[model samples]
Target: MFTIQQIDGAHAKVKTGADFPKYIQEIKELGVTAFDFLVSNGVEVYYGEEPFKTNSPAKYDPLNINENLNAQQFAKELKEHQDGKTDFPYFVKMCAINGIASWKVDLEEYTCTYFDLEGEEVLQEEIPGE
Candidate 1:
């Protein structure tokens, strides 16, 4: 089992999306099997083995998530963020504005999935890592 402090310490190294893959790798090594991030307030729920779970407190003020899903625009913003053109907070705010309610990353599958306001999967991408 891992604590939120440990996870947050690893996450603090992620200044931009370009740093995400490495962050995931570090946390994965910390026993985080999966994690879900709520876009509105930045709370995260981290999971490990059976019965191992921890929740992170909200990091930012709540933002209104747009009801309309703008997949195309979201994709564009995602690309820019992945390129390190924007910071993490900006990327999160953009996700909310584009109607993303949350996102989940599965360490075992090495996949990251974004969800819409209605909890529908908006996009799923393989995480690039060693």
Candidate 2:
């Protein structure tokens, strides 16, 4: 299992979405199999093998998740962020505006799925390897 400190150290290196693959690879190496991140407040629950799990407190103040699902705008912002044109905070604000409630990363599957406020998957993308 991974500690919050270790995860935080790994996460601190992520300045933008372009840095995500490296951060994911680092934490996955630390035994994090999966993690769900709440977009509203930055809370994250990390899972390891069976019976091993941990979580981190919210890193920021809560943001109201929009009810309308603006997939097109979200995709556009996501692409820009992924291209290294936006910082993490900016990307998160974009997510809130576009109605993303949370996101889950499956390290084994190399995928990240975003969900709406209703818990429906809005987008699922392959996570690029470092």
Error of 1 at 36 (Å): 0.2
lDDT of each prediction vs. the true structure?
Answer: 0.95, 0.95
Model 2 scores worst on lDDT over the 10 consecutive residues at 121-130
lDDT of 2 at 55: 88
Question: How far out, in Å, is residue 54 in model 1?
Answer: 0.4
Tens digits of per-residue lDDT for model 1, 15-113: 999999999999999999999999999999999998898898889889999999999999999999999999998999999999999999999999999
Tens digit per residue, CA lDDT, model 2, 4-108: 999999999999889999999999999999999999999999999998999899999999999999999999999999999999999988999999999999999
Q: How does each model score on TM-score? A: 0.98, 0.98
Q: What is the lDDT of residue 90 in candidate 1?
A: 92
